[model samples]
Target: MQYRFDVQGMTCGHCERAVRQALVQVDPNAQVQIDRAQGRVDVTSDAPQDTLARAIAEEGYQVAAAA
Candidate 1:
């Protein structure tokens, strides 16, 4: 499934990598694309949305479902 989230607090490359790593840990095969300037993250994974959101949240970002 594909999920879109508004994730705040990503200011650099390291922040992007941390969010990607967090998502990958939840679903090893997950694909993550992030746009820090827009606070956006697009993910393609079989994992549930809530689980993915939690992973991002654990990485210290504020996560919300995107339209």
Candidate 2:
């Protein structure tokens, strides 16, 4: 499944990597794309939405479902 999230507090490459890593840890096969300027994250994975959101949150970012 594909999921979109509005994530805040990502201001650098490291922030992007952290979020990507967090998502990968939750689903190794997950694919993540982030746009820090827009505070958006697009992910393609079989993992549950809640699981993915929690992973991003654990990395110290605020995450919300994106319409």
Candidate 3:
């Protein structure tokens, strides 16, 4: 399924990379796009939404909600 999340605390390239990596860890083949300026993360993955969210949270970013 495809998911769009509004994320917080992403300030730089590293932050974007971290979120992307976290999602990849869960779905491996998942597609992740982070727009730091907009505080949004768009994901296309088969993994459960909660699992994906936890991965991002583990990376120390706050996921406000799924869009």
lDDT of 2 by residue, 8-52 (tens): 999999999999999999999998999999999999999999999
- List, residue by residue over 1-67, the lDDT tens digit for candidate 1: 9999999999999999999999999999999999999999999999999999999999999999898
| TM-scores for candidates 1 onward, in order | 0.97, 0.97, 0.93
After superposing candidate 2, which stretches have Cα over 4 Å from the reference? none
lDDT per prediction? 0.97, 0.96, 0.89
Estimate candidate 1's RMSD in Å.
0.5
- Model 3 lDDT per residue over 7-57, tens place: 899999989988998899899999988889999998999999989988999
Query: Model 3, residue 29: what's the lDDT?
Result: 99
Q: Is candidate 2 or candidate 3 better by TM-score?
A: 2
Worst 10 residues of 1 by lDDT: 58-67
Error of 2 at 61 (Å): 0.6
TM-score of 3: 0.93
Q: Which stretches in model 1 have alpha-carbon errors above 4 Å?
A: none
Deviation from native of the Cα of residue 64 in model 1, angstroms: 0.3
The 10-residue segment of model 2 with minimum total lDDT is: 25-34
Ranking by lDDT: 1, 2, 3
C-alpha RMSD by candidate, in order: 0.5, 0.5, 0.9
Q: Find the candidate with the highest lDDT and give its number.
A: 1
